[model samples]
Target: MTTDTLVMPSVTAPPHSHRLRQVLHDSGYALLSLPVGVLFFVVVVTGLAAGIGTVVIWVGLAVLALTLLAARGSATLERAQLPTVLGRPVPRPAYLPGEGGPVRRLLTPLRDPQSWLDALHAVLRLPLAVLAFSVTVTFWAIALGGITYGLWDWALPQEGNEDLFELLGFDGGTSLRIVGYTLIGLLAAAVLPFAVRAVAVLQAQLGRVLLTSRAATQAELGRLSRGRDAAVAAEAVALRRLERDIHDGPQQHLVRLGMDLSRAQRQLDRDPSAARTTLAGAGVLAREALEELRALSRGIAPPVLADRGLAAVLAALAARSPVPVELAVDLPGERLAPATENTAYFVVSEALANVAKHSGADVCRVEVGLVGDVLRVVVEDDGTGGAVLVPGHGLAGLADRLRAVDGVLTVDNPRGGPTRTVAELPWA
Candidate 1:
């Protein structure tokens, strides 16, 4: 990674789908529902207290306390559900670490802004529930009552003895009576849907605003946190890889080359042909050492990947992979933001490398495509399948690399076979 690009490990799972929208709305409704239930329970308990006569005031205060207790629990449940339903990762309220006293824990939630907002949201729920109930229940009652009056004239007993027919200047029969009820029914029918719909609209807006975090803000926070972690992980991996390369690869080759040179020097006094053979072996060792050094350099972030962009780099990687690899690049020819390009390159490279070394696959497929506003890369190999992400391994390193760029990797290592690694990179 370049000095300008900071790599960090992040939690970059994509948000849940549209199916979660209904889940969130229902959760909001549930959060808002507690106040009405509390209200009902309080009213009943207060009425019971009135029957007892002496303890009505004390009982009312007790009911109030119970309602608040219910509200607090409701808020806690709402906070927990918001992450799953809304796909917003809000931290839960934590108790004070050492002191487990009631006063300290109560003060802790009061001090947190998120907890306060949640409490405020819970408090707002009661009035909203009342308003929603009034609008919905009242409209239905009026509409159904009007319909009943129109259809069943006997149900309008108050209008029976009245000269409503004469008041409308009509014969005192069914027609005048029918028309009055019919007109009321029609008016009520039209207004009812409008009223119910209006309430639902307003409630949805209010609840959505109070409950869900904006997707963009959540994404940015996730990106930054993941980036920091991946950076640390990547730095550590790079250092370890460099150390291994020096110790096992180039250092061994250099040692052999030195031994070869020493042998050739001793043979030069007596047997010129033997000395020539040893010199040839030393030359081959020097070439092998050079190749190992080149491989080490390539491992450290390839210069071609930086200069030519991810498409070209990936195309080259596919060409060189051990298996007959099918490379498909849907990325634009133009370069992306450098960090994003690097992360994508590392993912594809590591995936393909795994295929070559471990996966006994004949052919590997690598795809890079842009879906919606995000870039997706998938690499699949039809090989014996049991790929585990051990710590400090290549795939793990690649996972960390993708995280730095607000991307994620999903690996499928089913017991049956064929491991598939899919990576998603956000365009921004």
Candidate 2:
């Protein structure tokens, strides 16, 4: 037998490599800030100047409006460039659209608060950008020049000039000059990345604060609120359903078993044969209740899931299923988040249970895999199909549970043949 080993490139970057990459990005961004800042400042200042100077005529109103629009455009460009420094995209905010005539719409930028903020950012950023550019460039120059001082020292005019060490008044020589400057170079090099990143962040942060959209933020908050409410509702519904199932299934079975055992004890003294029959019935009821309780426990956080993860637990579930199940599941090597694994487990468990109870199919097929940033689970069966998501029903409960985790469940059950149920959850 021959063995083939295929090597794959590692995806996780080393700490030092990541640090170097970030430093390069910060350095590039910092170096570019001065020119970008200058362009913004000059444009904004000139436009405002012309607009204010022409205020005597109605033409000044149009100038001021156009200037505000230009400021907004500059702000947009600045925001787009920030992700290279911040390592994330800035949210774009919604602007108010004016109703009615052409002039009101043209002047809409003046009325918006975000537009004003953007314009303010354009004006204020120039000073910070200048500071950042000076510090970053000075530090880089010192580090480079000092480190390479020895290589270029002979070319400089040595007759009438004092080197850095000589100017300090201690001493002056070729050896001293090289060693002293090299030390300074090493020190500056050590702090160069941090210094550059700090200044770049200062400049980029202003744009983020001014340019981030309020509407986008509010939409995100609303999504989280809805998820919270769904979680609460789903938990309540699950608890109630569990209580109902216990009451109607194993709870009633145990009660009947107790009554049968009591009857058997009472009959034992008078009629031995009658007592034996009652005892046998009680034994059957006891076994049934035990099995039902075991099934309920399987739906919960089983130890196998924590030890062996979703794949193993799913294999066990498929083995126990009444309908023959063909499971094809591909998962990552590491364990998923606890809540995600639990939700996925229950989705499959409930889905298989439905296939057995309602589908009445000879065979069922289950496919599960991570599709990009989503965990998708699909169960299909060749059975008589009439499934629906009615309120307070199993399918409805599944829908609610999926929604709690920002997941969705859909079923395609036609009149007479096959049924397919698909559930997709975020890869949280």
Candidate 3:
């Protein structure tokens, strides 16, 4: 009878034991903030005083601008430091580019609102840093001193040690006093991690409110406004183009077919053979009209795209392209949102159309895939590439279409070779 046995390799502590590491990180941040905060506060305050005091002399303007620039730099450093404590990125504020010559550029920072905000943050941080540093250092020192009381208490002149212990209601004995101090030390040590974390979080939140970019909402609103305008103009243009196509193609064919049938009816009794020929011509015109209508419908929303998904639609596109196209598509089994699929399809269609019309390339490669939560489509061609997104151009229209859906279209076409057009849409 043999006993079943199991053996496992030795391992260190579990990954959740981050209390010590967190405490050390917070403590280090607090200590570093003190001197850095002091330095920023001094520089900013001095610069402001000097700039205002000497403003009539014109030297103040330069000093003020330089001070704001320095404040921006300090805010940037704070943003860089926040991610470790806050666990997320803080985007930098956007600043307007300075126009004109050397002196205008020098005074650019003074006109910016974000630069002033940064200066305010730099000035305010000094007091917050002082509080964090004092609290953190004092807690650590008390905790360590209490924990080591047993080892070092003997070195002290021990005349009144018993009275000290009795005052705390512990027995008047050396062992009791040592035990009490160790317990108090253990309690402080237990609270140290939490205290440091609280201070760090407070400082990080303050920095986030003051130093980080507040323009994201404004930027998004502007994008949506532009996108709405573009969408309206594009829709109007598309409607006009559709009307023109119908007028040129199917509408003319139908009119000619009607005329031919009328002629056929008139000649039926007088000349049966002539009527037959006219009827035949009418039938040909009818079929051509039907074909033109089908093409127009496909341009609007292809039957294949509705039936299958983007994969089948793209396969049909590849089959019909003027030049040889290498198609690669990796999509989810289920279909994407209708708008996303439609936008992606049109982007590819327009890009390929541009290639066929403008780019003199022998072969093109089209790649479509779901990259994370984004629908990405890339159309690349080896051609004489000098593509620019001029207004009213196909690429510009594509950009407008993409912008309407918060998608992006990028064209990478340099002179003397390959052009790569990429369109990305959010999958959601």
Candidate 4:
């Protein structure tokens, strides 16, 4: 035989209107749900005691080389049951501390607050959900049955009407009918809705208490994570820049210098004048290598960019580039963090370089302005199509550099050309 399981859709009131009413109703119901609260409190406190005791027992057993499977198994079930009833997501119990030895498992429970809370939540959930669910269900059943019975009695208008209302545990004749009908209306309009809302609010509160971090703590963690991401990106860019500088600059020059020396040796036997010319070429190559190394060092976190700030550095880079650059800078010299300023300078420099080398654009525009807490830099070029993220290129390095400072780089290279690279760096 084939069986089909029916899935019921969730019924929740609208967030603004119905939800708000539900919240208020739940707040008032919290006190009325006193028995449930007390029961939950007892269960939670007891579970905490048991869990702590169990950990101690496990440690003692581990010292004797006795199996601890039973203790661990029990704790696992206790914690798992919490999420089922409370409707809050809680983690399951993993291996206790000190599985490697007696000291670890014993100390593990002490170190973790969540472990203790999990045990406590599990122990308390059953009592709380049971008491609260029971009271809510009972009240609803009475209100519904009373109203329904009374209405049937009133409509029938016979000797059996009195018996039906009485059986429903209501007052005599008209009085019974009125009370039952009134209760039905009130339950439908207020009581039932309030009960469901109260349960949800309580569940949310418990979930937050046992699961999610506090608002302030979460905000702090988010900030730290962003800062870390930026730092990592910056380091990555620095490494790439070092690699490129070595490959294109000093390394290539040194190889050529070596070849020139070999040529000089060959010429020295036949023609001394030719040998002198080769030596002169090697000298020139050595000087070129030194200049390339210096340039690479400067790119690896330049002191000039740090001391003078971003605007000056960018202006210098733009003035020196092969392409003509029009810089419109509006940032206050003292308002930027050293990191933020350095990253911005690189973004503009890299973008302009791309324009000169690849974009085939004649003229480029660079603008730096502060918008509230963030510094916005725009580099636009009327160049050929296709500016994409190519690994190891200036554009990719620029993106990494900006990200290191909690900044973002957006390259809008539409099909028709005219690529716009906008970099936003957050002020410290």
Candidate 5:
């Protein structure tokens, strides 16, 4: 009989190995908080004292302002360090700038709430750091000492000393005592990683709360309000433009068609030949009216855009443009949302129209691509560069349109030549 030997597959470590590494990293971060906290506390305290003490002399006010500025700088440094522990970007808060001359600027930090918040963080970090440092050092010392107790225990004078196992109520026999102490060491080692992580997380959270600025929320709210206003204005302008286009083009053609047909009806009985010519003229007017209507509709939403997407639509636009256009469009295989596509189309259309009208350039380049979750479009031309986003100008309307969709439009046109217009929209 032949015996078959089975080979076992090697087992790999689980996903928790990453967590173990993170805990180790966080432990080092926690330990570092001790020195950073102490240094920050001392600096802020000294500054505050000197500033307050000298305030009656007017120089104190300047000192106090500088102190607050220093506090803000320290908070910024701490903010930079957070990504290692938190694994995400922490946005810096905006500072309110003082207007006018150097004196106003010097005093600006004093009035800023974020600077005061930074000062508060500096003051509070000391106690938190002490707690974190104590936990880390105590756990590590106990764990390492107990883990290697067998080597060091014999070096200690054995006359009056009771072993750790005896103190812990374990039996004092040599073999059992050694096993018990080692078990305690093993338990400490296992708990050390978790303890370090917890303390580090707590300290990081405390810094985040105290150091980060609250002004970001306020700024966003203000931007949203302005965007809403811009949207309403843009919609009003679009409606007026649509009304004007209909009145100027299709409305006039329809009126002329009606007039021609009426005249043809009158001449049919008296002069049949004349009536035929008039009727032909009426047919021509009818066709013109129909063509104008189609063009207007196309301006609103091109049918080809819906069917084939942006690439095909842009190619058509390039072909139709008065000046030569170098077009490069790179989009994903799947279609984007209808709103995104429409906004992008209109922005490019308007920008190109402006370029053809105003920029006396022989050739222009249009580029469109996706950058992460943003859609970026750039239109550049060699033109007499005096483009400005003033009210009543095309660029102003373009800016409003972009703002409505949480996008932005920027124009760069120096006096000599070369105009560049960039529009960015969020893809998702």
Candidate 6:
């Protein structure tokens, strides 16, 4: 079977009412852009010209600074209006931080590249806004006029007039006239949505490129950097937890095993019976230590996961869980990306470990399935709930692990009841 696309799926047509509503929104944005754009253009251009004409005077410096400030205000307002067209919040661009003396602070805007870009956008958007407004108004008039032709057609005097049909070598009958106008209206109406959408997109895209593109890129980079940092922190926490567990569990058991063997050796000459009993206890201790090590080792990368697949590894986990586990997996026959499978395995392992250790529940449920381009892993337990993602805690580590690969984690656990952990990962 083929895999589905994992990001930015193809756009599909919405319901008619929704489409019409969106068209109205687009029209409103189009109508508003012209006035807003013109205002910005006039303010920035006038200020810049006046400032340049008098730059020799010290007053020119202040004029230029204030002009940049006016441009920024216009840009901010436009940014706020952008969501109507873009359907996403526009992030404010980071300006140069003001520092040092009053003169230095006043001059900060001149040095900032974003401020210049903002000013440039203010000057350029006026033409685009005019174009969009012209197209939108013209099409809207044609569509509305033609669609309502029948209602208003009889009001016009037709007694001595040669209609357009007559000029075109056809009968100038009223019925034909109305029909023709209505058909023209219908044609314009058919193209109205696309026209509005095009204008809105044009305006929104230009605003985005000029205003927020760089800031958005920087934000994304910051997010990735944070995720990487979280991954490193999670690794550190996991290693520490592993070390503590080993020291407490297997290390202690090994010490006991060693002491048992030593005691048995001393008892062998005094009493063979006691020596045999001590040896038996030592055998049990060895077995327990081996099992504890194996259990801890499973959380790390297990070879069976790579050798067999996710299903086999999940089955093994279910079989070995301390709390009875109910596992359900719905996946394609082929293997997923190694990173995806590894994360899923770790999620299940960690979640189950939490349930067994803290949940006090009789049973836990684990489910893994592919939904569109996302892999969803869910673990639910019917016990005392109140699960939280405290920093340095297991849940937080799990969250970091998921975030490292652009995944998300959510937990739903109220005070007194069941706990649910859900992780969504991009299907690589």
* lDDT, candidate 2, 1-428, per-residue tens: 11222222232322685877877777777778788778878878887888789979877767878877888888878777777777777677777778779988977877887777777777998998888889889889989988988899889988988776788886757898898988999888878877887787877877776677554565677778887877777677778877888899899999999999999999999999999999999999999999988877786668899999999999999999999999999989888878788888888888888888888899999998999989999989999976788877777777877887888999998899698999999875
lDDT of every model, 2 decimals: 0.66, 0.81, 0.82, 0.64, 0.80, 0.86
TM-score of each: 0.67, 0.55, 0.62, 0.58, 0.58, 0.73
For candidate 6, lDDT tens digit of each residue in 1-428?
11122232122324687888878877888888899888879989998999889999877778888899998997887788778677778777678899999999998888887888789889988887998899889889999999998999888887788877788988858889889988998999888888777877777777778888767766888899988997998899899999999999999999999999999999999999999999999999999999999978887878899999999999999999889999999989989999899989999988888888888999899999999999999999998976789999889998999999899999999887699999999877
Candidate order by TM-score, decreasing, is 6, 1, 3, 5, 4, 2
Give residue 415's error in model 6 in angstroms. Answer: 6.1
**Model 1 C-alpha RMSD to native:** 9.9
1-428, model 5: which lDDT tens digit per residue?
11122222222221585866776667788787788888878888999999999999989889889889888877877887777666667667778878879998899888887788889888988887899899989888878877887877667786787877678787757777666767777888878877776777667776666665364565677789998998787767766777888999889988888888888889989999998998898888788888888766766779999999988888888898898999999999999878778778887887788788888988999999999999999989887866788875567877887898899898988887699999999977
Error of 2 at 17 (Å): 1.5
Candidate 1 TM-score, true structure as reference: 0.67
Which one is best on TM-score?
A: 6
* Top candidate, metric lDDT: 6
Model 5 error, position 164 (Å): 3.3
- Residue range 396-421, candidate 4, lDDT tens digits: 66776676566788999997789999
Q: What's the CA RMSD of model 5 in angstroms? A: 13.0
The stretch of ten residues in a row with the least summed lDDT in candidate 1 is: 1-10
Cα deviation at 33, candidate 3, in Å, is 0.9
Best-to-worst lDDT order: 6, 3, 2, 5, 1, 4
Clash count of each predicted structure: 9, 1, 0, 5, 0, 0
